[model samples]
Target: MEVVQVLHMNGGEGDFSYASNSLLQWKVISMTKPIVEEAINNLYCSSFPTSLTVADLGCSSGPNALMAVSELIKAVEIIRQKLKKKPIEYQVLLNDLPGNDFNTIFKSLPNFLKNLRREIGGDVGPCLFTGVPASFYGRLFPKKSVHFVHSSYSLHWLSKVPEGLEENKRNIYMTDNSPTSVVKAYYNQFQQDFSLFLKCRAQELVDGGCMILTLLGRRSQNPASKECSYIWELLGLALNDLVDQGIIEEEKLESFHIPKYMPSPTEIRIEVAKEGSFVIDSIRVSEVDWKVSNNNEVNKAKSVDESLKGSGYNVAKYMRAVAEPILISHFGEEIMDELFIRYREIIADRMAKETTQFFNVTVSLTKPK
Candidate 1:
């Protein structure tokens, strides 16, 4: 199956489900709270409607899934109070690929709604939720429908692996030692994908509407920068270790490609300029620990094999939740637990000497009135 058919966060509320392992994404979104609020403020100043339309694109199923929406809702509630008038009724749309765990989200909907109503107070009007499963690179909403749009940690996923990536043998993503063709392929793919994203949102957003997007990005123009590509490079080493042990086929390693890319600020600016839909308000670049955390709790009663600790372990769980489906599709389901076990070990070892950090890019855009 194509990755589009298989790529999704681990479904259900199991131990490894995204709901169980999304602290990192939550942190990223939290860090962007002020940014999201800024967009909502702009929305209030511009549109100021009693009924509003909002969307969280790439709203994967998990604890972090509601992070963006909840924050936006709170902003909406606060705005209504500040205006000292009747509260607005909201239409909240959560969008992701069809393979996403919408079932889990819908099942948990009752509690989510209850919490919103309780926290936002009785003065607030109704808030309706809908799950929209489709590619954000294309039209997902009617033209000029959404008042404000938000997406966090989601734009990094390319619609598909770049063409000719089979030649990027021994690596699934761009690397320091990668050929020039490999570098160009990844960058070009990101350009096309992000351009289409802006174009679609341009159509969906009304005049003077706003968008706040936070995505993984490179601090350097070179896609081969250590901070940009080292995660997958280390992952490549782990896969080769599995091959060395004769546990997996080497051919399998060469054929697999990750359907993700982290674009640079330069690339993003070029795409936004070329697309010419939304004016670039500002781009705020931030840093996050690649390990997600420096500490993971340990339970004395748990066996060593049953428990893992520290940044590596937490980051491993986060990656596994979001990327496990692709791995299972490529390598089969049986190796998943073992594969993550190996990945965790590698991450832990690397953590001892270096700070594992990644740069994030948050761009604010406004559709012209």
Candidate 2:
């Protein structure tokens, strides 16, 4: 599959769409608010530009699409008020793959603008929102144009699946059982893609501009550790179940692989040092429970089994919303319902035995003047 062409969060606001199932992503965004605020503040105070340009790379469609932009705007407004500075004109760029639901983000703009006006009023400058449909792994903006950049739950995605993975067999991603060559290939691809990403962004960002990025990561030095591999391993098990029942072709499973890699914190720092464009301001590693949810009152009433089952289903829906497009591209859409059903059961069974969480890495960087 063409990663650029095929990759995107599930579009629109449906039960299974990314818009409806992005609580974990939202939590990551919220968790990194202070870092984002500091970056925006630092950038603003550096020059106090009359016009500030901010770019949200991989700004997938959903309530979370404009979330970071909103934070940046609020941050700028607060600083302006504190220093008694003039209004700073805002240029916000929302970027993602061409297949992203730009329409969904656009549809919500009226309310977004209305709320911004009500909250900040005339003190806020013109906030121009533009959607740039392109890949962040390459240049998407002009040189020295963007003042601040933010991306959440992106960057783990490789520009494409690594080459020479035919030996990877039934796995869709790096697994403990993967051959040494497979592991090396994945890391090599990540290093190549991330370096190019830094180079492109370095060109796009003005001197002393700031960028904050949050992505799925592995705490373990081992790329095959459960932190990053278990989720896909379970999904692979679900696919294997289908193959055993003659529902999917074994050869298809062998050929299909996800174009994503969860790097470790050490790996991230190493890349930043190697790239030589940005200084690493801060790097934070945190974990969010795989069973992330907001349904507290309802959960209190359910039995242990009921809660576990509900958690499994919720996690399945979240994964489905994120992975459905890629899976559908390779496996066809007919088996989706059944695939996720099996996936839910497998997750529930696993959760009954142990707690699982996603490792997140949030990094703050700055271009030296």
Candidate 3:
């Protein structure tokens, strides 16, 4: 079965726009810095070149990538200072899809570099930064070129939509009560994409290189598990309402899915082990509370109220971003406002039931020495 190539939604930075939010900076620092430091230390201990090259796969626009790069440089400097070696040149590669907002990233780079230079007082050696526009599942650099690779909150996205989903005209995802057939298909697609990702990364990394990845994940293998986020369920309900009102046809909605898969940490370990190129180093699981700001909450509530007040058109933008694109294509933007309003209320209710959000898994791995 051929995979469907749905139009990419959620834009370059992925949902939640972490790149632009200052509150998110600390999250990236705490999660990414130590893993990168470990990778660099291993490389240095192995007598790898002092000039290290690193790649930040799925690096989107804005300050987040730069922030990560800065931390990496500092970690490398500390390692060098401890070893009493002179500073060495570093080459950093930032990669994302071709259509990503490179303009924003380019605009942010110079200022970031200026700040870094001032902080280190020009002691940090030559640091080269460049952007590579290519799919992470394909070859984007020369063999054995990357010393360390890192990705955060990006790998959960499937390389392509599942096969037979578009052909069978079935929703790519289903709720807890969804049929076994639908769930099985989704799992199979995830398995395939994950295997491809491992194969691709294996080809890119040097013999002893390391990859540190953090993504949304589930703790259970049960397809009926409700551990999946309620945000998705609310969005599905909104889309169904639109379909009921004849604002959008069912066919259009079936063409797209959420493009997310939450695999268990054990499942991930098995896949990586099967690929036989990477050894699992560590796994960390934690709950990430992703509450929007008060302003956003207020605005969302306002939008919902307006839609409920017969101005359903006003909430389309919010719903469209959260809803399946196929629904938007068929509905023609008429019922989006109402859909969003209803969706927000449902999500808020769910949140009230559970104040702290639960679930995420981080896995650190290394290629054989």
Which one wins on lDDT? 2
Cα lDDT tens digits, model 1, 1-369, are: 375688788888887888888777788899999888878877885756878899999999877788788899898778778878677888988999999989888887889888878887757778888899988989999999899899998899999888877678778778877888988888788888998999899999888888998888877878888877777777778888888898889998988888888877777888999999988888988998775643346333255443334556777777788888888889998887788888988877777667778789999898989
Cα lDDT computed for each candidate against the true fold: 0.83, 0.91, 0.65
Which tens-of-lDDT digit does each residue in 96-137 have in candidate 2? Answer: 999999998999999998897788755778889999999999
- Misplaced by over 4 Å in model 2 are 294-301
Please identify which of the two predictions, 1 or 2, would achieve the higher lDDT against the true structure: 2
Superposed model 3: Cα runs more than 4 Å off: 1-29, 166-172, 292-338, 355-358
lDDT of 3 by residue, 46-133 (tens): 8747688888887756556576678777777776777778778899999887755667778777788788878766377888988998
How much does candidate 1 score in TM-score?
Answer: 0.94
Q: Is candidate 2 or candidate 3 better by TM-score?
A: 2
Candidate order by TM-score, decreasing, is 2, 1, 3
lDDT of 2: 0.91
Ranking by lDDT: 2, 1, 3
Candidate 1, clashing residue pairs? Answer: none
TM-score of each: 0.94, 0.98, 0.82
